[model samples]
Target chain A: GAGVSQTPSNKVTEKGKYVELRCDPISGHTALYWYRQSLGQGPEFLIYFQGTGAADDSGLPNDRFFAVRPEGSVSTLKIQRTERGDSAVYLCASSSGLGRNEQFFGPGTRLTVL
Target chain B: AQTVTQSQPEMSVQEAETVTLSCTYDTSESDYYLFWYKQPPSRQMILVIRQEAYKQQNATENRFSVNFQKAAKSFSLKISDSQLGDAAMYFCAYRFNQGGKLIFGQGTELSVKP
Candidate 1:
């Protein structure tokens, strides 16, 4: 079975630009999550969705960050006016959403803001 | 807020030897989950092992196991008969039993030497 997958393994953009990272969770997964990982650091939570609606968005750093999962499937993390501080790897994960099930993660998309 | 800590920034172990990576966390919730994830240079996060806070018995997966001390707020990963394939960055993560986001530690870079 295919695990979570992210698109554009690497992306580079200038500051103030806008970018979108996409994630395709495993089929039949009811829970989806996004996380940001800085250099030499572990991943920090961003947002989580359960069946198309976000269950938690408190981990989003600022208003510039937003994510959505439509049709209870694919998800996208959008950043407005990207900053150099946003340069990090964006990771996507999915789980069965049943009783503390383990999450399956993707390779992650590395975003670089110059 | 929950926090996880991995004091060891790096650790090296000889092949076929045993190695333990330390992790500690602070949380008020009695029921939660702890996980160890391995990230290779490929940047893929893979589940190593998981321990439920309510489960007094530790969790084990093949050569990988966890020593979970709920009262001490400690969770450590022990790898026996380590192999070269085990070389990677290990992260300790925590999530509530309610299931939302994950709080991760700084990570421990493990190197396996022959």
Candidate 2:
């Protein structure tokens, strides 16, 4: 695709339900990132992947939140036993390379927990 | 840890006028990158402009320019001849050249009046 693409623009799930968000980054981009944005707040970094390995997972809020980029192209963010506080827009971005490269973002997945 | 701050929660400007959005950041790293992203109602995060901390000259992209003060650790966006389409949430972001993670500010909501 020309730009980073995220699946299921919106998702509504009950608390404690498991949810998975998918992200397809731009072709040839080696770096992918996942972020969470609450209402009236900026996006918070969740995880970063360089190729197939997670370069940084320190930003992941807790064990309930996990992300994977197995093939170095498409990434998936999984939330287990989701809580009401998990309700937010999940954004996916990709950059061509590390170090000063501008990242391209997707439209984001708005997750609403009930 | 690096932190980015956008103090103005909201700002408004008339069409064809100019608007400036302020941003400040704290980082011990000498080499880093600064960015301004626009997120409209559509929820797409768009890159407006970017500045390299090592560069002495400011960066400009069409009507969008930045007043980057490296010494003060401030990067402000100046929009010339603002348009209704420019109404969106502007985010200030920082990233270290060595580390790939991007630290974002609280964001400023921009409203362009007719």
Candidate 3:
């Protein structure tokens, strides 16, 4: 079975620019999540989607960060006016359902904002 | 708020030896999930083991096992018969049964020696 996949393994952008990262969850997975990992730090939750709607997005750092899962299988994380501080690995994961289920993660998209 | 901690920044073990990685988490919730994820150089996060807060018995998978102490809020991973392929970054994560988001700790880089 195909596992979760992310597009643009690496992206480098200038500050103030807009960026979008994509994630394709495993088939039949109803729960999707996004996280950001800075160097030397653990992954921090950014957003979570149970289906087409976001179930929880409190982890999003600021208003500039937004995510969406329209059809429930694929998701996109959008950043407005990117900042250098946004440089990090953006990880995507999916699970069969929520609550205690093991999540399968993608390789992650490394975004470097200059 | 939940916080996971991995005190050891790095650890090394000889092949065929045993090594344990420490992890401690703080959560107000009574029921939750703990996990250990391994990320090799490829940067793909792989699930190692998981423990449920209500279960008294520890979780084990092959040479990978966890010593989960609910009272102590401790979840440690022990790897026996270590192999070179085991070299990677290990992260301890926590997720509440009510929410789908995962809170991760700073990772420990494991170096398996031959």
Candidate 4:
């Protein structure tokens, strides 16, 4: 019954610092995804995991961004040398990996690189 | 390879009225999924409705429904009896049948007035 959940509802950090955003998927969900949404823009896919392994990560913009999902439930998005351009809402979603299962999203974590 | 487009940046409607938001997508794949998601100020993405490409009939959820045109690559969301609570940014998204990353459109901000 619990929807996906993300930690640190808001995070403000200085440029060049490192930051980590965490996500907890819904119970029994086997698929997880991460997305980044800039101001006035639609959310862009960053990574997807169909268990503990990432199935597709082509959407990751650059080397500065990385994500990992271990044990197939929890995921963490880590940014190194954060930039002002990285300021945006980081969203997480999960689904059952079944046919046509709708993804349930978490309240995204807004990250601001000051 | 897949892209979603939302033409309306903002729309307003009186409570109890109906409003439609238009979306179009470009994709070579025939089997895919289309969805409408709502994001409130709280930054949570919620599924509004979904339409499977193979389904000839449109998808509906209560007052929310979608007009999905496969040949034209057009998908539009129609909200009936729009409530003040429906005020939010609406996004059109697309994904392939087997779990993959989502392609989202620039959102439409909807406002409902009493």
Candidate 5:
């Protein structure tokens, strides 16, 4: 079975540029999550979608960050006016559902804002 | 606030030896899940093991086992006969029963010596 996957394994952008990172969840997965990992730190939750609706977006750092899962299988994380502080690895994960289900993660997209 | 903490920033073990990584969590909720995830340089988070808060017995998989102390709010992972492939960044995470978002710790980097 295929696991979750993220596109453009690496992205480099200018401080004022915009970038979009995509994630393809596992088949039959109902829950998708996004997390950000800064250098030398653990991953911090960003947002999660249950089906097509975002169940939570509290982890998003600010208004510049947004995400959507239109068909419930693929998700895109968008960042506006990227900053140097936005440089980090963005990881995506999916699970069967909430509760005790384990999350399967993607290989993460490293975003570097110059 | 729910938070997970991994005190060890780095751990090293010789091949065929045992190494234990410590994790502690603080949360008001009683029902939740704990997880250990591994991330190598490739930057993919892989589920190593999971333990449900409602279960009293510890969880084990192959050479990996967790000493889960509910009363102490501690979960430690012990890897027996550590191999070089086991080397990676280990993270402890907590997730409430209601949501799919995960709260992760600061991760511990483990290295294996041949």
Candidate 6:
């Protein structure tokens, strides 16, 4: 079975540049999630999407972070004016939308803002 | 807000020995899910085990098992016969029944010695 996958395993950008990270969840998964993990720390929730709508985006640190899952299958996390503080590994996960269903995670995109 | 805590930052165990990782979470919600995830050097987050707050019985998966104490708000993972492949960062996470976001604890790095 195909697992969750993220594009550009590593991305390095300038302090003020824009970057986009993509995630392809498992087929038929209706619940998608995004998280940011810093070194030596656990993954922090960023956003969650159910179907084509974002059910939660409160975890996003600031307005600079935005994500979209327009068609309900693939998702894109966009960052505007990336900052050095934004450097971290961005992880994506997906589940079957059932309560208590396990979330399968992607390899993640390591974003480094220089 | 819910918070998960992993007091041990690092732990080491000889191969084939058992090692336990402790995790405690603070949450007002009665119904929620607890999870233990492993991240190897590959940086892929793999689900280790899960426990439901409502279930009194602990959850076990192969060499991985969890001692889930809802009353104590404690969830610990015990790895039996730890292998070198088990060396990784272990994280404890929590999610409500509504499944909006996951609150994660600072990871515990485990090293398996030969």
* Model 3: CAPRI class: high
Cα lDDT of model 6 by residue, A29-52, tens digit:
999999999987899999999999
Compared with the true structure, what per-residue lDDT tens digits does model 1 show for residues B3-57?
Answer: 9999999999999999999999999999899999999999999989888899999
* lDDT at B23, model 1: 99
* Per-residue error (Å), model 3, residue B61: 0.5
Runs off by more than 4 Å, candidate 5: none
- Pitting candidate 4 against candidate 6, the one with the higher TM-score is 6
Per-residue CA lDDT of candidate 3, range A2-113, in tens? Answer: 8999999999999999999999999999999999999888999999999999999998999999999988889999999999999999999999997778899999999999
Question: DockQ scores for all the models shown?
Answer: 0.81, 0.90, 0.92, 0.79, 0.93, 0.81
lDDT by residue for model 4 (B1-114), tens: 888999999999999999999999999988899999999998888889989999999999999999998999999999999999999999999998875788999999999999
> Candidate 3 versus the native: TM-score?
0.98
Q: Is candidate 2 or candidate 5 better by DockQ?
A: 5
| Between candidates 1 and 6, the lDDT winner | 1
Best by DockQ: 5
lDDT per residue, candidate 2, B21-80, as tens digits? 999999999999999999998989999999998899999999999999998999999999
- Displacement of the residue A25 alpha carbon in candidate 5, Å: 0.6
lDDT of 5 by residue, A1-114 (tens): 478889989999999999999999999999999999999999999999999999999999999999999999999999999999999999999999999988999999999999
Model 2 chain A, poorest ten-residue lDDT window?
A: A95-104
Model 2 CAPRI quality: high
lDDT of 5 by residue, B9-104 (tens): 999999999999999999999999999999998898889999999999999999999999999999999999999999999999999999789999
Model 4 / residue B67 / CA error / Å: 1.1
Mind giving the per-residue lDDT tens digits that candidate 4 earns over A62-83? 9999999878889999999999
Where's the lowest-lDDT run of ten residues in candidate 5 chain A?
A1-10
Off by over 4 Å in 3: none
Q: Identify the runs in model 2 with alpha carbons over 4 angstroms from their true place.
A: none
Estimate the lDDT of model 2: 0.95
lDDT of 6 by residue, B1-114 (tens): 899999999999999999999999999999999999999989899989888899999999999999998989999999999999999999999999986678889999999999
* Residue A38 CA displacement from its true place in model 6, Å: 1.1
lDDT for position A4 in model 3: 92
* A51: Cα error in model 6, Å: 0.6
Give the range of the ten consecutive residues with the poorest summed lDDT in model 3 chain B: B95-104
